[model samples]
Every structure is written in C-alpha cells, then in structure tokens.
Target: MTTHHRTRWLALPAALLLALLPASASAYPNPGRVTGDITVHDPTMLRAADGTYLLYSTHGGLEARTSTDRIAFSRSGNAFNSPPSWWKTYSSGNDPWAPDISYRGGKYLMYYAVSSFGSSTSAIGFATSSSGKAGTWTDYGIVHSTTGSSNYNAIDPNLFVDDDGKWWLSFGSWWSGLKMIRLDPATGKSYAGDKTVYGIASRPTGTKAVEGPSVVKRNGYYYLFASYDTCCAGTSSTYKIKVGRATSPTGPYYDKNGVAMMNNGGSPVLESHGRYIGPGGQSIMSDTDGDLLVYHYYDGQAGGTAKLGVNLLSWSGGWPTAY
Candidate 1:
C-alpha cells in the first residue's frame, strides 16, 4: 500500500507448459494452469453477473478487460472517473491500481488505489457501476489516505466478506507491511482505526520491503497470500509469492512445514521460473470449475515485462498449491 516498497531484480517466468501438468504432480504450483501472454499486472478478477470473468488489472492506471474462457481477453475501458479533481493529474499522475471489484446488494462496488511511487501521499478510493461494464461508474473520493509520511504506506487494498457476512478491508505497504480492519459495509469506511494491524509482512526481519496482501479461503483453510521483496523493477525485483494458512480468517497462519505465517513462515507457492520475475501481487476467483489464483509475472514471451498469469489452485494437505 505504501509507495516505499521499491523494486528488486527481475525473475524470468517459468515455462508455460506447467499449466498442463497434473494437479498431483507437485506440492507447489508455480506456473499456473491458465496460460497466455498480455503483460497483465496486479490483477483483480471476478465472475461477473453476466457470466464473464471481468478482469481489472493495473495498467499504469486501472483498466477493464473481460474473458469468458479465462484465457482469452478483450479490453473493456479505462478508469471510471477519468481521474478525480483531488488527485493530481500531472504527467498522467495518481493512477488507479490493484482494483477489487465485487457485487453486493445487487450493485457493483469497486475499491481502487490512487498513488504514485516516491510519495507516501496515497489514497484508496471507491467507485461503483450498475452494470459492471464501461459506463455508469461514480467515484467517491478518498476512502483512506497516506500523507506521504506515514509509516504504513497505504496502497494494495482487498475487500472481503467473512463467513458471518461481516465486511472488512485489508491494506498497507511493504515497509510496515500488510494490515486489516473492520469495514462499515453500509459506508465502506473503517469501523476501527487503521492502527489495529492484523497481518504484518515485515521485510524478512533484517531486510525491508513487503506488501501486496491477498487473503482467501479454500477447503476450510484460510490462506494468506502476499508478494515479498520487490516487484516491477524489471530484472531487479526479487518477487515471490509466499503464503501462511490458518483455520480461521484472522490468522495465526502456519506453513506446510507447521511454521507460523505471522512469524514469517510461508512456504513458497509462486517464485521466479528463470525470467518470470516478480510473480506476486495476487488475487483469487471461483466458478463452476474451481478457485483460481490470478497474479503477474515478468514474461519474456513478449520481450520481457510484468504480464498477468492465472493458475488453477488446489488445496492439498491443508496447503495451497498452484497448477
């Protein structure tokens, strides 16, 4: 969430054929099942009301695309608001990144981040669409803000409705790491102070930089997936997908080796496959088939850049393994 999370060396993504590998092949699914190339990054996808997987990925600013097959895609449109007045528009500034699109109360709710690097002054704003398409989206200014001096650099945001139907928002930076708070479902505001941090992905104890927290559940296990080290620095980022699992939503998550996730004990679910660098900043979706972990990887298929990758996810032995 914070702008302080810098980039590391790029990792070439693994081979695309790993998608066809049998699910029982390995414990960790690094190269996902869904395959293709388009340079998708910080991806957020949903099975929309119209039966389309509407993928809103971070394209400098937020852009909309849709795919029914999950492999083929078509661009839909750009950010709903055309850049709000409060957010600086200098040099195509204050991009809308890492979006969370959901349908509640028969209306679509979109939570998007507006910020630029080297500045802690960031904000997570809200938008809405009646049809979840190109037209009719209204922006609500600044759901949360970072003064460019805050320790917890607010950026990547995730919205979830728990088992009890309680809504909450999880966000923060790699500097101070990831955090969560109860949300006012009616207002989309934090019910408690953002200070009450729940999950913190601090920089490997001695080192720094850890952000992009995504939380989901599978087969009664709550899996906390996050990208640590660096992302988007081309070949300099040391991006990897690490996860901690728990029995409950608010963890106390443990790795496959029985180590605690809160204690920085996450087994690797996604790491670089040579040139597939920074394969993190992930999201998940479910359909008639199953759950899918959607994220980005530095793809060399198009001369090397951070492109989006989707892999089918399966839970085995209480751990999340990609296909």
Candidate 2:
C-alpha cells in the first residue's frame, strides 16, 4: 500500500467520529456561523497540512479563499494566474465551475469543469499543486469531456479514492444524470484499462435537474450525494442536496426508501429553508471535528447572493444527517 493510503486509513477513526445524538429529522439546522469572504459558488475546500483551510470555487479563474480557523475566510487569489487557453474551447468566456480538491500521492490535485450555461459541450480539467494554494496550480489539461451529441454532460467533477487505492471520478449534469470513470493514480487521468462509464445516479422520469456529485465511503457503504432540481436561479431556485448509498463505489445506489437513484430516488439531506434558499452544490469534508457538509446557498436576506454554508454531519444510523 502507498504511504498516502496508509495515512488515510490511520486517520479514519477520527474522521468517522460523528455525533452520537441525531438532530431532529424534520428541522433543517442553520449553517454554522461564518464571516468575511463567505460569498462563493460550488465551493470545494480542504484543510492543508499546515491547518490552513483552502477554498476554491467557480469563476474568476477558479477563485480562492483561505481561513485560519474555518470561520473568517479571506479571499486569497485565483487558482490560476490566468485562465488556460484551452478553456475558451468549451467556454467562450473561459468560465469554469464546481471544483473538487483533494490530497493524493503527496500532492494536491484539483478537478474543475469548464462550459457555457446550458451547453453539453463541457470539459473537466485537472491541475496539481504542492502546497494547495492559489496561483501555484499547474494545469494538466482535460481529464474528461463531452460533446453536444453525448448522452451525458461532463461538469462538476469529484474524485473519490477508494480504501484499496482505486480512484474514481463522478461528474455529469442535465442530460443523462451522473456518471463515473476509473482513474489511473499514476497520471491522475482516466484509466486506460477501464473505459466503461458507470452511471451512479439519475432522474429518468421527471426533471433531469440532478448534478454536482460528491462520493464518500463510510461503514462499508459508498454514499453518493448530489444536488437536485434547478440551480443558479437565486430565490427562485429549487436546488437541494440528496443522497443514496451502495455497497460498491461504482453503484446501483438506492435511497433510504430502497428506490433506485437512477429512477429519481434520493433521500433529502438539505433543502431550502427560511433565509437559506436553494441549498445545494455540496461537498463532504472530513475535518478534525467530524464530517462536514460544505456547500453554497442563496442568501435570501442578502438579495439572493450565493454564500458558503458549513454544517457538521452525524452518521447515527449509518446514513449521514447534516446538522
């Protein structure tokens, strides 16, 4: 096993130290208090080895923010000094969205998507950094992409490294739901041996508004968390986070009710409530305290501005409950 894998397993005990007492299921808890530079979209965060929190989000060449205590964040800079030239091929304006960051193989890797609004022609790009800081990333080009004629869209990339050292990337939007591809750990690119695109979740019958997938393993089950319904509409957005689980990383995921995720089945994790409107675009982080549900929500009190939302999760009954 690799040293990285060994370190991760040793840290699992602390990462799985969730709250024993579950929160009321009906009451969606408000986000934990945060201040300064909280406005963000599709935020992906990870605590560096030095204990500084690094956050990267959509736009502004993948805008960045840093926090010493995970509360008062300050805008650091963009991940890239300038948008890569290849980005213009998918997005005329060089817009990228929904970045997923991780520490693997002794390096910080980031996967982000580039595409124009309502377009299936999108590309997921990869980059690497030694320090997990803005302006230090070196773009490695596209990892996966889709054309207008493809059945699925390739945006919102999330990398999931299994317990046995296998890497899987889950991403998609609007066309045919979420999909996953095996990754070669050496290259951080798609595995040449396995070209099969696995469909993990979808909404086949109703609105195909499911996207932004984040996968994590806990208690012998692989949980798939995704956003559902329309997003980016501010106060009118119906975006919410939902979840399903399977025994394998490449899954036939089922919701709490045993309904298949491909058939519009997902148990709600977080939804629009009170001043927190359209809560979605979530990523799960294993922090010192516990598992955290980190995402963005439109602030009703702030004129529909997108802001960062953080809440600890409890795995009281084998399923995660965001509190």
Candidate 3:
C-alpha cells in the first residue's frame, strides 16, 4: 500500500478500522522507553546466551550495538572490521543491509544483503561465527542474488526453520514482492533439489511497498510479518508492520479476515501514531517476559531520526496485538 492509501485508512471510522487492523489502530501504544545509542534503521535484535543484546542495523558495514538490560544500548563495532572483498561484485558501496542473525547447530549464522538504493542488482550473503559478537563473522559468500533482469530484488533476508527441521529463507523487495527458497541447513544456502522461489506476499494493484519479512511459529501457526509502505523518510515515512499467518512455512498466508497475503492481504501489527512514526523493519524475539517486537521508528520528537522501539506482543486472540 502507498502512503496515500494508508492515510485514507487512518481516516476511516472505527468500524472500518477493524477491516484493516486487528484493533482500532488509533489507540496503538507508544513504544517502550529506551535510551542511549537508540538511533537505528531496519534494526534486528538478538539476545545472546550471556544476557547481552546484540543489535544490528543497516549501512556502515552493518553497524552493531549492545545492551545488557535491554533499556540502555551502547555503540559497539561493525560486524566486519573490513567489508568482504567479494562485496564489490554486487554492491558498488560494499555496504551491507538488514543482517538477520540466528543460533543453530551450536554456531551463530548471519544472513545479510548487499545492494544499492532502488536497485535490483543485489545479492544475499551469509556468514557464520562461533560467537555472534562484532569482528567474529566468517563470510560464507552469496547465498542468493538477482540482476536487473530479474523481477525480484534479493534483500531483507529472514531465516525460518520449521518444527520438522526444514530451513527456509524469505527475501525480496518492490518489483515482485516477497520470495522464499528452501535452504540447506548444513551450507546455509539454497537447497539444490527444490530451488523454487515461493511467492509469499505482494501488492499487485497499488504500491508495491512490502519488505522486511520476519517469520516465527507460535501455537501451530507460522506468522509472516513485513514492513509496509515507505521507509527512510524520517518522520515523513509511512512504514508500518503488517502480519499474516499460514499453516506451513512457505505459505499461502492469510490475514485475520481470510484474505490471502499474496493478494495484498495483511492485518496491521504496528503503524505511525503520535511521536512514533513509521514503525517497521521488525523482528520478533521471545524474551523472558513475552514476545518482544523489536524494530526502528522515526522519532517525531527527535527531528525525525530513526530510533529503536520495543513493544511486547499479546497473542491472546490468536493474532499478534502489540501493547
């Protein structure tokens, strides 16, 4: 959906709001308080076994930050002390974006993207580390890629492993919407046999504005969350988080009203309200308290600078509602 479309949705009556969101979006809560080195874009947060929060965001070689109590974060170092030499083959700047980190097989795996702005000549790369801290990444090279000839742009990667031990990587942007491919667990790359790129979600008619997919399984359902509309416009950005659910990981996912995600179907998880504008690029982390919605939003009070916003999710009604 476009910013104009979202603006109209915001103007709808309360009853109409129910058609687009799980609840009346006018009452969406402000983000939980955070301080110190909060500025970020496309933030992906992971808490290590030692109780430290390692947060990564876009650009500057995937800038890294850390926090102990989750309230006060401090700037750390970039994941790469030097950009991988192979990066220049795909990205002109050699700067990476949207790094997704996960722990599996007693190792830390990070999947990131190398691309320039508004371009489809992009590549998705992978790295592994014994520890997920800064300067420890060992580049495994490109996992998937796309050229200007391709319909999809390969970026914003999210890895979802199912209960049956299947690995899937979902990544895409503007041109043809979200795409997923089965991954080999051992190599952390695309599976050779089933190389089909699954089309998960898109806006066919209006703005093709969905990206940043994060999938998590809860109570027998696999939820696919994505950012909608414009990002990086600071306070003017219309970015918000939307979600759909399916029984399988590579899904014909559906929203609350049974609309298919592939047909532009999504129920609002978070959106612009008050000082919090354009809350998106979200990742779900199951914390000690509950499922934390970790994302970045343009802070209206801070000259529209991007900042981290964390909110606990309530899944009481079988759909995620942020409190």
Alpha-carbon TM-score of each model against the true structure: 0.83, 0.92, 0.91
Comparing 1 and 2 on TM-score, the stronger one? 2
What TM-score does structure 3 among the candidates reach?
0.91
Tens digits of per-residue lDDT, candidate 1, 1-323, equal 01121111113234544555565554444454344335677888888876887878775457778777676777777656466786673224656778887888888888877777755677787878787876457887777777756777667888878888777677776556676767777777766544354664454475456667788866777777888777787766688888887776667777778777555577898887655666888887776666777888876555657777777676867777776
- Cα lDDT tens digits for candidate 3, 114-174: 9988989999999988888988889989999999899989999999999989999998888
TM-score of 1: 0.83
Model 1: runs farther than 4 Å from truth?
Answer: 1-37, 89-92, 192-195
Return the lDDT, model 3, position 83. 93
1 against 2, candidate with superior lDDT: 2
Better of 1 and 3 by TM-score: 3
Per-residue lDDT of 184-278 in model 2, one digit per residue for the tens? 99999999999999999988887999999999999999999999998999889899999999999999999999999999999999999888999
Better of 2 and 3 by TM-score: 2
Clash number by candidate, in order: 29, 0, 0
Rank candidates, lDDT, best first: 2, 3, 1
Write down the lDDT that model 3 would get.
0.89
Cα RMSD of all models vs. native, in order, equals: 8.0, 6.9, 7.2
lDDT of 3 at 261: 88
Worst ten in a row by lDDT for model 1: 1-10
